[model samples]
Target: MPSQTKRKKPYSHFRLRKFLFFTVPFTILALFLLRTSSSSSSTASVSSSYTTYQPPWFGDLQTAQFPWNRLAFSLTNPPPKTLKLAVFSRKWPTGPNPGGMERHAFTLYTALARRGHRVHVFTSSLDPFLKTDKIINLKIHPHGDAESGKWRYNKAWELYQEENQKQPFDVIHSESVALPYWKAREVPNLAVTWHGIALESLHSSIYQDLIRKPGEPRLQSFNASLYSAVLPKILDEIRFFNNYAHHIAISDSCGEMLRDVYQIPEKRVHVIFNGVDENGFTSDKKLRSLFRSKLGIQENSSAIVLGAAGRLVKDKGHPLLFEAFEKLIETHSNVHLVVAGSGPWEQRYKKLGDQVTVLGSLNPNELKGFYNGIDIFVNPTLRPQGLDLTLMEAMLSGKPVMASRYPSIKRSVVVNDEFGFMFAPNVEALTTVMEVAVAEGAERLAERGRKCKEYAAEMFTASKMALAYEKLFLCIKDERFCIYP
Candidate 1:
């Protein structure tokens, strides 16, 4: 046979040697992985268990019992033993805003300062016209640079807290979003005055955009991005802010929204409509013609001159205004639309190829001139309305108005067909209403406008708004001071 060699029997020692060669590294690796996993699990557990408590900015004022809960008052009473006030804002009106909220802030600051109240405005420099006794301009990175810019805003908020620690204010009055939430507990008394509230899906979207980007295309994002991205975040923030403070609603609708959105206690919310300087928005013939002439508008043109002023964004119904004007033009040969204010969609709306006059923007004094130049003023803002200062000005100007029948506008500003026409938000309904308004003519419309002016003169005047706020502030302050006194 082929000389087969006897195979040696395998020994346990030889098998052990082979096993060690293979198993040693694997064992080491398993142990290393197990150790690593254990460390990771321990870290995660610690992280999960740790929680930080952030005290509310406002104390439990509304929930306080008896006389303490009731707002104290001082009508023809002595000045407080100790007076301290805190004002919060996000942006002051400095550079390029259409001068709505900034003007209100400047006016509020000046008025409060003149009254000898120690008013401090904590805000961002994004506002162009804001200068006051005390201002905290939070540093923020330039727009679109989120990574670095975020830190700036974070630092600014931290600075606000750090600075407030030096001297605690007796009362905190905030105009911007969520300051009352952060500062409520730190301060004794807090009152937040809202400029607007988010009621609808669209309103919520817009507010989130304002929170994210103060200006530009982000503000103009519509149905696609609004529903897809903004809606959820806005809902979250609204819920957060609503629960954060003793919320003040600027309009009746806002109060209702607060009640509906957060189930906020009825006692915690109050409606305080914004007011305008009635004297500044007067109707003068010479001023009217001066502005009309500047716009190449003939005073004698039989056309129904309709004016829509404010930022020409999609929501403001600038496109709808154009569509309505195009239809109204077919019926009324003398119809002209003058648009004042500017935004991202200005050129796009301008390209609609209508006979509408885009006046871009006007100064405060000049805005009155523009209002006077027109026969009827329309506030075609789309969703979730409050009182736009322009609507107040239009009412003050004795020019008949046409506004969207949104809850806030209808409740706060729009009285009736007597004051202004309340129409549907769509183009067809708005266009049909415009036709009726054009047919109403200047004499009848001016009469309605006069009534509106009277209403505004008595109710919506700045003096009236200021006096109410003063009373409310003094009442809160007196209560807080009395506790210590």
Candidate 2:
């Protein structure tokens, strides 16, 4: 019996070893194959998404002209239906001077209000000089302390909540990040307009570096901190943006980034360009002559006045403009530069003497005069984020533009070369364009300005932008209103 047991144990051990040898190898092979399949499937899925995904509205935005005449008819001869809009803006335009986004909010909401819609604005404290008595159908709910001029989003959100409960808003609009994602996720009829996104800021940073001299310090260090800091933050923003119900990109490039890079669904993403008050900025011969006379440039003089307006910061490309204009003035005595707005570079522009006119900060009326006064508007901004309203304003004001060759400007504003000249963000490129403007003479530039005014009137007017937003708001309230022409 003992001998038989020993023999059986050895036989059992041998069988177990045989099974382990075959089964282990087979299991390992199966795992390797499964992993390879999964990796390939993931890669294919990503590639398929990029190749196959196409939004219904995807097209050349410049050519896809909105039916302004039809939109006008719809707005003027509409049924008795008006939207109750809730707007979240960090800072409302109180005084004559406001930032671009604030100006945009003011223009859009005021236009909507004039169209008989009720706009309830929840924003920071108003300026002491502002008078809101004339604004009709638009109620202001100011939160936060007025002394410090600090905006409190939480307080503004609280006010929004209270008003919402009293009479639920038909649609909610957030100007940039005034309303955070956590709150936005709960609202179905909400759309956040991204004037600029973080990825665009990354692009701006890259361009900033490119514009820098070869040996100059890079804006961002090329080190482990980039991997550990900048990229992580951008990735987090990309993830967080998905929580919003809808996105309204202010530029065509921005719209594509939201849909493709941020992975926002096509149905939830829309593109709407910024608009300016056309009436305030018009082609007036008398005004242009008067403004030029004020600037000491004779009406019959051959001197060409080139204008720039915005915060005089490095990111605004003042350094490049300063250098380029310096080189330009060294040869072309007929070219003059006019700079509006105030910042650190204000004194630097002042040092350019009579060749450059620093207007300090101008009010709305002064800005109108500034646009009319110049022969050609020049915007040498390095940051490639938001579409500068100055470009639209310049065109609408009946003047040609010489702006940077950024994608936003190239794709949206400067779609046709006849509108203006575009150059790379460098001293040599800008100087060359400026020389061309000088050579074209003021009369030829004015001819280009005429074409610019006609196009700007079609695309960049406040009425068109308002009607577009009104239609979008109506569609959000009722899907049946989402019909396209």
Candidate 3:
């Protein structure tokens, strides 16, 4: 019995040793492998997401592959007299994201369509632009980004050119300087208008100073290589600008910018100021009061609502305006500011929160209501923007304008104490202008509003812009004057 007990004890000790030495290590090893495998799987999923989407155009979809020298299409069918017009842009007008160029393109297209012309707009995606069940009228094509699975406009242009080899339209309208086109040689009477060049845009005093901060990698070291390399290539294409069928400028200054920078002949550069839908901006006092009430303004208070809209960037002069507004509040009572739009410096303007109403972004109709409610419209632009559609809308809203006298604005907006006031694009100058305008009282403002409406009706209407573009397209079709004037 003693011998049997000793044997059992040795066997039990062996089993205990095995559990301590092997089982614990094995369990830890299994957990480590599981964790590693999970991490690897997640990484693989992320990598695969970026490369999967192929829109109609980008890669293997070459529409037209003719050499640069050979541009004209072989006439398989007779071309129409009025010409089938097509305009291609990188993006379209959609609220706060919509810049002047996009609105100009849309208004031009809508006007053309109204005049019995079939206009097709090729865009990447309408995600943020506008939503609708019926997109049949616009012919929008969706192309996804290479990694994000989203469509890109440049890629769509490549595909459209490849698919439509016959040069279906007499002329092609291109908004960006960087789109693919068919028939490099004949060039199909393509009309290209630049919103404005970056070379000129970044040369502004504020932007130049911001990029030159100490301890910062020079702007030259960062994105400078790209602009340095690509812009010259883009500008070299400008000889074709004046030579194209019609070159429309948003303002006389924009036309001059092209002429001076590109040496584009004056004959080819026709000034066609951008226009707004005046009918859409018509306002009534009842509508104005309703909008003001919703915005929390008391009806009896002598509340003066001053509003401005644009990207919240320094170039738009929000900082300067804020400074001026703070100063104005010292002497004025019951003054309120309504700011609409978003940008990088959204938080910087918070100090004026109580005195100012920050309505981030509003739709076209909402903007019309806001404009009508405001006592005056202020455009404080630190950069050169094309004919600002917002300013035009404000003018059409029957409000007086206090705008920056940038060269572009000076050429486009007429300034009179009776109609509106223009100030140099600086804090002191703008402050003085606003102070005077605000103190001028209601009768003077009403007279100014009347002139503002008349100015818009005379110059910045959609019909006038459309007619100018049509005439320009006709000139291009006829090959009127090949060289710059």
TM-score to native of every candidate shown: 0.70, 0.84, 0.71
Q: Which candidate number would show the highest lDDT if scored against the true structure?
A: 2
Query: What would you estimate as the lDDT of candidate 1?
Result: 0.62
Name the lDDT of candidate 2. 0.81
lDDT of 2 by residue, 133-230 (tens): 66898999999655524678889888998998999999999999899888888888899999888777776776777776778876456545456766
TM-score, model 2 to reference: 0.84
Off by over 4 Å in 1: 1-83, 96-99, 126-167, 178-188, 201-231, 234-239, 296-301, 348-354, 480-485
Better of 1 and 2 by lDDT: 2
lDDT of each: 0.62, 0.81, 0.63
- Model 3, 80-161: lDDT tens digits are 3455666767766544456677777777887666565666666656664456344323444444564322336566666666
Which residues of candidate 3, in runs, are more than 4 Å off?
1-81, 93-97, 128-130, 133-138, 141-154, 178-188, 202-245, 295-300, 415-417, 479-485
Q: Candidate 1 lDDT, tens digit per residue, 1-485? A: 87699766779779889999999999997985566355433322221111112222234333321112112233244344334566666555555453566667666555555455666655554422344344332222122223321223343445556656977665677774536355454444677776765445465345334323224465344666766765765576566665444566666556656665557776566555567777888878898788777766787755677898988776677666767777777766667788888887677656645567787878787788888888889887765655688888888888878987765666556644477788876677888888888887877877888888876765566655654456556656664522321
